[model samples]
Target: MSIDLKTIKHISKLSRISVDEKRAEKLAGDLNSIFDFIEKLNELKTDNVEPLTSVAETTLKLRPDEVKSKNIREQIVKNSPQDNEDYFVVPKVIE
Candidate 1:
């Protein structure tokens, strides 16, 4: 696959980037090189390879869900600079 000058201009327009006539021609060449590299990668054989999530095999340790701390809303809210009966209070912004 290869990119053309007209396609490069269209891409520049879509990306909202300003490209001079000379730069557009250069961009087309760069895009063509990228597509050529991708085509070369496509020729590689990976039939026996497994999709990898990480470089090494490891297990993530998980703990059983249980309540570790008792609720202390009253004690926590007692020292608040601004708080309501059950939540923090903030200055109103809208009129």
Candidate 2:
């Protein structure tokens, strides 16, 4: 399928984009060339080609799920605007 000037104009109007006749013609040609390239690719025989699962051959190594936080409670609590001994003091929103 190829894109025409009329199709480009309609698309521009539907997308609320302003395209002049000169620019619309250029866009139509560019889109037509892209479609032509896709058509050429479709003509190629890929009957024996294996579908790609991943770019890399190796599987990702996953680490065991575990808590890794070091004891930094005092450091974090220092940044709180109003702090209790071991909790955050915020304006109570719920009744």
Candidate 3:
């Protein structure tokens, strides 16, 4: 799609931006150049290309998940401002 001066003016007003006549014309030209580049890219043929995460092949290292600490609820609750039987209590944060 082509960008016109009227469209740029409307967009500037909606975004609370002040663009004088010269800047508005300049922006329209820049936007038209961007659209022209996109149109050129659309002429390419890529039917057999595979999407890639990276240009090179590699493996991600991972560690085994294991429980390493015993439950210490009572000791932790001692430092809190308030606590019930097995939980710590704090002020409500959301409405």
Candidate 4:
């Protein structure tokens, strides 16, 4: 399959990319070259080749979910610069 200037213009319109006449002509040539390379790849014989998914053979190790602390709210609030017993006070950031 080959790409033409008309097809490139249509593609540019669909993608919302502004393409001038000179650029569209260039795009047409570039797309045609890509398609030609793909066509050449399609001609390759790979009947016995296995489909590859990943280069590395690694498995993720998961740890059991458990809470380390039960009650530490008083200790955490003591370290704050400006603190309220219920929640930490923050400086006004938005107008």
Q: Rate the local accuracy (lDDT) of all candidates.
A: 0.85, 0.90, 0.91, 0.88
User: In candidate 1, what are the lDDT values of residues 5-51, reduced to their tens digit?
Assistant: 88988888999998999998888888889999999999999899999
Candidate 3's C-alpha runs over 4 A off are 54-57, 83-85
Q: How should the candidates be ordered by lDDT, best one leading?
A: 3, 2, 4, 1
Tens-place lDDT per residue, model 4, 1-95, is 99988899898899999999999988888899999999999999989988777877677799999999979998888876797797677778899
Q: Which ten residues in a row have the lowest lDDT in candidate 3?
A: 79-88
Per-residue error for 30 in candidate 4, Å, reads 0.7
Off by over 4 Å in 4: 57-95
lDDT of 2: 0.90
Score every model by TM-score. Answer: 0.71, 0.72, 0.72, 0.60
- Which 10-residue span in candidate 4 carries the lowest summed lDDT? 51-60
The sequence of per-residue lDDT tens digits that candidate 3 reaches over residues 1-95 is 89999999999999999999999999999999999999998988878988789988788889998987778777788877886767778889998
Which candidate has the highest lDDT of all? 3
